[model samples]
Target chain A: MINVKQEIINSIKEITVGHDIQEFIEEVLLSDLGIDSIKYVELLVSIEEKCDVEFDESDLGADALKSLGDLINLVNKTLEQKVS
Target chain B: MKQYEVKNVPRYFEPHVNDCFANAYATVLSYMGNNPNFILTDYLNFMYDEQTEHIGINFFFRATPTVEFSEEELNSSLELAYLPATSMFNKTSPIDEVTDKDKVQINMYIHEDQDIAFTRLKERIDENKPVIVAVDLFYMHFHRAYQREHGLHAIIVTGYDEEKRTLKIIDKYKLSSSDFDGEISMDEMSQSRLSECPLNNPMVGEYKREIRNLWMEIDIDPDFKMNVERIYSIILESCKRMKGQREVLGHECGLNRMEAFRKDLLLKKESFMDRKLDERETYLFKTYYNSAFKSISRSRMRFKVFLEESNLAEKEDLGEVLEQLENALKRWDICANLSLKLGIKKSIKLVDDIVRQLSSIIDIEGEIINKLTDISLTRDLVTVSKNIKDQEM
Candidate 1:
């Protein structure tokens, strides 16, 4: 299986399509990435599609997504759970 | 190729006021330089009716994102706020009955016939009136929603080329919010005007209205005079309105509605406190909360402008009011932003923060009302003094 970290990065790039903020540092706050409310919805949806795992829209990984690193970790944890 | 275009239309992006309808009106008003006061001050007046559940602003400060405003409601809202409700303007506010050539008329229409619509747009452009038309962003190439999302929006159509079948749009509504103005094919414009984007973007939420070639033709007389009495009365009405609830155009509105709304928000927060929230519930909650604060925040900012523009508020009075208003505006922005975050991530922290911010906003708004009341009483005293001095002389 592809590395879950790679999958999250790819999703980030995909969401940044047609957007100005293309490159981002992992330590950057997710807010600094210019992901507005609309983009936030799109990113969450994109991450769900990319990981091939449905994120609990309610609170599963949403609260966990304050930073880029958090998103990567959340996706990894989700993937690990899937494997188990 | 036949062409009709209105030249030098001002771009519509008023700071702290992104309401498409109001900005659209600003386009033509600024172009003529006719009624700066009307454009700035006298347009938006707060109206809250306790009889119903309508606690929002007048037509000019309204949009079609989370709410579908009816024609009657639109007219009545203006009438209650500060106007006698003119004809069919999709985006309108308080229309003052000014003297001389400084007359403003708004005519709204929903045409099923594209040809008829084109003819009307051309007719207005010929008179230098930049028409504000309702549109669905999905059909417009410039918008990110082109073929992606369907949400109702407004744009200014300034020109058209017959052979190319293109309309020049200055879509400055929420320019910071991913909306852009660009030329579009007549077919795209027509389709957008008559669109039914049932699956609208979840972010902006869905509206229960039809676009259907709906457009507003604004006829502003090139000479405008500030109606201080009218502006003063509207402010006075707001001072009375903030005290309690009253029915204005069938919507239960007032500053009191905000507390009730705040309580509702608290309930929603508690419901999602220790429980997994439903997706639709979250979306609806976010949409409803944002729409309210968006209008409320916008309305207060405009009120601040209105007060300053009227030249009625003394410098000291205006200073204190503006500072407090600006603070409250910032807090409303914070609350709205937090509400959206709460929608994304169910957090009691976000809820508590919004509740705290909103409570402060209410207090600041109360102080604003009292200050405005003092100004009004001062104005009345001056008016009576002038009359008595004239009699004594």
Candidate 2:
């Protein structure tokens, strides 16, 4: 199984520039990290690349991707689904 | 349910003025089997408010000196201008508070649930009704440039497929050839309906979709004479009110709006001449000038068509006024072309020449509008006499 937390952190880092990585925590809201709709798309694209899985519409529901920790959980779930 | 598409719906693009409501209304009327020319003429009547001001530019200045453009205010202005019930135009407004008592009905509905919206859309389409949906531009995959830009726009949903999960739409501002008749995934369409963006208000990061569904039912008036009289009265009132001060937006009508735009352009040109123009400044100047020119020119063309197609043209001396308006429009076109060239070449001489020509055209247009206004008032009196005669008989 892929390290979903590390992959998500790495993907977020790739999409966002000029931000302090140390400030990021699992509980931090994605909006607080400057993840707008466009940037959110970018983050998803980066994570999909690392996880080798594409996200369906249902997978990107607003409630499913509320926080950084939530996104990490989603990445792990999608990865598991892809393996199955 | 069987699928149906409204055949030969007349499509119009008023990109510079943002007349999506008019376009959508026209589509609805055409679908109801109304004469396209008559419908178009009615559309032109809606362009001018009761005070003869261009509805799009009738912005209310909320506070001193600072002009604020609110879409909500504009919608109210449009309603007042069209006088939907009398003008034979479809009544439309935001879904939350649509209380139009007009026989010709158009209403909007918002649904938070995508499935319900989709089912409702398909049901309407099956019944040969085209639904106008307001969506955030960012999530509409077909609009690539606007895919990242968050702005609320309305498009006609012509068809949908449950099996393919695709939606067929008609976008008036077809940026590319492929955009005119386009399709987007249902998922994307739903996301766009729910998507919130910062374009309208930066402070409010999410914009709730206010107009999700548009409902239209047309009841065309059979009395041509009555319709003509109503139109003439509206035009006459607009002309008379042109002189009155509007509390919102400094200008009352097209002539005043053009005057304001000309003065603003001249001031901007002078500042650019004083300093080297940067790329951003040049782009902004081009956009402002182009939009202003196109809006006036297109509206003038529609006004000409309205005059020609409607019974109002038969009024004595009205033809001459129409000719004068045409001449002014032609001169304005030349000035706009020169202005465009000057923007690119940055020639001070050209700037001065354009400003002079624009001022002259504005004067000519103002004179023509006043003449038309007077003529329409006289026509109104004649109509009143004719109506009285009919009643006495």
- Candidate closest to the true structure, highest DockQ: 1
lDDT of 1 by residue, B78-168 (tens): 3112222224322244332332343455555665677777787887787777888888888878876788777777788898899988889
Name the top lDDT candidate. 1
Model 2: per-residue Cα lDDT over B1-393, one tens digit each: 344454455564542222554565666656666533444431221122333212343342111111112334433333222222211112253322224432234444455566666776776677667777767777766665455576556678888777677777787753221146667787887777766444432222333433333233333333322266545644554454344423333434455655665676577677776677665454333334433444555555655665666666555677876787676656655554554444454555556766776688767766766787677767668879999999999
Give the Cα error of residue A63 in candidate 1, in Å. 22
Interface RMSD of 1: 8.2
Report residue B27 deviation for candidate 2 (angstroms): 2.0
Error of 2 at B79 (Å): 6.8
DockQ of 1: 0.07
Residue runs of model 2 more than 4 Å from their true location after superposition: A1-84, B1-21, B35-56, B59-105, B136-152, B172-179, B197-226, B244-270, B278-281, B313-316, B332-343, B346-350, B384-393
Docking class of 2: incorrect
lDDT measured at residue B329 in model 2 versus the true structure, 0 to 100 = 54
Distance from true position, residue B47, model 1, in Å? 8.0
Each candidate's clash count: 14, 9
Pairs in clash, predicted candidate 2: B50-B238, B51-B238, B52-B238, B53-B253, B59-B249, B60-B248, B60-B249, B61-B248, B61-B249
lDDT of 1 at B8: 78
